[model samples]
Target: NAMEGRVEIFMRNEWGTICDTLWDSKDGNVVCRSLGYEGFTGVPRYNSFYGKGSGRIWLQNSSCNVDETSIQNCIKSGIWVHQCNHSNEAGVKCVPIRLVNGSSIDEGRVEVYQYNQWSTICGQNCSDSEAQVLCHSLGFGRAMNINATAFFGEGNGDILIQNVNCKGTESSLLDCGKDDVTVQNCSHHYDVGVKCSSVRLVNDTHEWEGLVEMYDGGAWKGLCAQNWNTAEARVACRSLGFDGSTAVTQPFKMNQRIKAKFPTYFDCRGHERNLFECSHHRIPVKTGWYSNDECTQAEVRCIPVRLSGGYSNKEGRVEVFMNNVWGTICDAGWDSVDTRIVCNTLFGYSYGGTKVSAGHFAQGVGDILLANVSCTGSESNVLECKHSLMTDHCTHSKDVAVKCYQNIRLNDGKLEVYVKNEWGTVCTYGWDDADAKVACRSLGLPRYYDLKDNKKLP
Candidate 1:
C-alpha cells in the first residue's frame, strides 16, 4: 500500500511530505526503487493528485535522476521544512493489485489500482489461468481458489475491469489486454475473491523436486509427512503453476530442529487446485522442533507441461516438460476439439484450434503427455479429455502439434476444416447466411459478412 501515495518521510519523529515544486517522474522512479520495486512506469503526480496531504511539507526543490537509488540520494534542497498551504503535494501510482479483507494477504477479494484510484475487477467469468495471473501479480505463486459469488464482501467505487483474458505469463494486472482492453459497468455481486499460495522445493539440486516448504502463516513451513500423498502433491505442484497429468509426492526426511510444520491429515482428493483448500486448521505460530520420526517433510516433483519447438508461439510441438523422463502418447485419437481445449488452457482463448500433423511445426524432443486425447468439443481443459492408460505406444515421428486459430486471422476464407491431420476445403453446396454467421462468431469477427452461394474458387 505504501507503493502509491503522497511522498512522505520520517523527519524529527514525525511524518512529512515532499514538495511537488521540483519533483518529476525521475524522482518517482527513485521512490519506487527505494521501496523495492522494479522501475515501472513511475508517473509523478503533481498538485495533490492523491488529494492534499495533511502532514508538514518536509523536503522541497528535489531534482531526482532516474538512475538514482533513492530519493535521499537525488539532488534535492535540504529537508528544512516548508509552509503547509495544502496547494501541491507529491504522490504516485505504482502497486497495481492487492487482496483486501482476507485472513492472509494471499486470500481476499481482488482490488486494482490504476490512474490514481483503487477499484475491483468485476465478473465471475474468470478462468483458473486468469486467477493465477492475478495471484502472480500479487507476488503469490498461483491461485488456489476463486470465490465468484462475492465471498469476501463488496468493494468500493465502480468496477475497474471486466471480460479480461490474461495469458497467464504476465507480471502485473496492468499489463493485461494491451491489444484489447476490456471495460464494463459490472455490479458488485460478481466481485472476484481469490486465494493464493506459494511453494518452494528445498535441499535438492533439481528444479522440480525438493523438500516442500509451503508458505503459511507468514513463514515457510515444512509440510508434515503425516498423510502426504499423491493427492496433496497434485495440489502443491498446481500451486507451483505446473499442470501435468500426474505428480510424485513422497515422504522426505529433512529433520529440522525448529521449523514450523503444516500437517496434512489426508483430505485432498488430488483434483483440487491447491493444498490449503483441502481443509485444515490454521497453522499456529512458530513452534516445536520437527524430526524425521515426528514430522518428516514432503518431497514433491511434478512433470511440467509446456509447448516447445514452435514458430511464432502460435503453433508448436506439444511437448511434455520432462524431456525424456516421461513416455510419449498415442496420437491415434488426437483431434481438433482436443487441440481447442489445449489452446484455450495453455495459450489464450481462441475461436478454434486445428490439430496439425504430428510433424507439422517441429518434432517434439519430449514425449507428449496426451495419450489418445479425445474431446467432445465441450471440455475446458485437455486434462479433462478422455485418455487411455497406455503411453509409450508412440514415437517422436507421431509427436503431435497444433495451430490455434487465435482470433480472426481472416474474415473470409474457403472455410477449410482440419480432419485426420489433413486440411480439406469445405463444400459450399448448402452454405447460407446462418453458416456464415457461425463462422464469423467462431473467428470473433464482425457480424457483417457477405455469403457467396454456389461460388467457385480456383
Candidate 2:
C-alpha cells in the first residue's frame, strides 16, 4: 500500500489529499520521489484508482518537473484549496526493477518492486524473450543471457511473476503477458538470473530482426557475409535482444548505399556471449557487387511473426515467417480450419475465422511461403498445420488474409449479416446474446458468435 495509495500531504498541522486537477506524470514522479522511490516509471491514477480518500482537499494544479526534489518542491496553490472532492484525489504507482546479488548491477537474480514489497520472478516460463523485456525496462540495451537455474542465487520474498511470455520487444516485463498471479508455484531454487548487454539493434523495420551492423571506430557498419555462419548469428541475435535465439543467418542483399562494412570476420564457437567476444580479425572486402547483390552483407531474422497490410493488427494478410523472411500463404487450400490456426497464432484464440477473397488484404510481394494449407482446427500455429510440399508455383495474387475474432457471418464492416441472399443488420431493442445465438443457428453456424457491442441507432 505504500507503493500505491491515495496521495495525502501533511500541511498546516493536518493531513489532506491533493485534488486531481492538472495532475500529470511529472507530478506523479514528484510524489513518488518524495516517498523514497525512483520515480522514473511513475504512473498517475487520475480518477482515484487506489480508491477515494477523506479529509480536506489540499493542493490543485500541482505542477512539477520530474527532477524536483519532492512534492513540496513542486508549485502548488494554497493549502485547503477548493474545486475538487475525494473521488478525484491524486494517486500514483511507481515501477522499480532491479537485480540483486549479482556480479554487477546489470546482471543477477531479477527482483521487481511491486505491492510495497520486492518480489522475485519464478523461472517457470522464463526465457530470452522475457529477459529482453526485463533488460530493456531497466535502461539496458538488451538481454545477453538468462539462466533459469538460479544463476546468481535466489531471493526470499513472494514470487510475483510466475510465468512470462514475451515477443522480445516490450518495454516492460509487466506488458509481456505475465500470467495471472492467482496461482503461485515457485521457490527460491527456481528463481531466474539475467545478464544484459549494451549492444543495440539499429536500422530495422521489423521488431526482432534486421541488418547485421556493428559499431566500430564511431560509425555503424554492416557485417560482411563472407565468413558468417549460424555460430556467429547465434551470438549476434542474442546481443541484439533476442532470448535464447537460434538465428536464421542469410546473405542479405545490399545496395550501394551501405558505404562501410565490418572489416573483421567473426568466427564464433557458437557459445560466445557476443560477436566481439568471438575470435575475429581483418578480412578482405570483396568488390564487384552491384545492385541486387545477394549476400553483399548479412542479416538475421531473430525468429518473428507479423501481420501486414490490414486495417488492424489481428485482421491482416497471413504472412508466415519462414526461411529467415516473411512470406505469404496461398489461398489454394486456405479455409476455416487454416484460418483458425493463423488467428490463434496471432491471437490467443479465434472465434471461428472466415477467409476473405484472394488478395483481400492486398496482393503480397515476395515468396508464397505456404500453399495447400490445411489444419484440423487444433494446431497452435498456422505453420504447424499440415500442408502440401511447400508452394507449388503459388502466386502473389493468391495471397491469403483473414478476419479473426469476428462473428463468422460478418467480414469487414457493420450492417453485414449474410441473410438469405441479402445483407443487413439485426435491429431490435432487446437484441442481446440470445438473439445473436439464434441468428447464428439460423445461418447453420455454432453459438458464441465472437460478437462486439453494436450501438443502438436512432
Q: In model 2, which residue pairs have backbone atoms overlapping below 3 Å?
A: 128-243
Deviation in Å, model 2, residue 4 alpha carbon: 2.6
- The lDDT per prediction is 0.62, 0.65
- Each model's TM-score? 0.33, 0.30
Q: Write the per-residue lDDT of candidate 2 for residues 1-458, one digit (tens) a residue.
A: 46667788888888888876666556777777777886334555554667777878888767777489777666567667666667667777665766777744457888877777777788887878998778766645556678787878878868877778889877578788876463366688988889875444444455455567664323456765666677887777655544323244443444324546545567888776666456654332242341234445676645344567888765777776653346777788676777767665555444446566666777788677777887887865666678765546777877888766543344363335535755457566777667666655433345443445443321
| TM-score result, candidate 2 | 0.30
Model 2 global lDDT (CA atoms, 0 to 1): 0.65
**Cα lDDT of model 1 by residue, 308-425, tens digit:** 5677566676654332243445577876566667676655444466666676655655435667778776754555567765466677788767766644323245565556755556
Backbone clash total for model 1 is: 0
Q: Mind sharing the TM-score for model 1?
A: 0.33
Per-residue lDDT, model 1, residue 451, is: 40
Q: Model 1: how far is 199 from its true place, Å?
A: 1.7
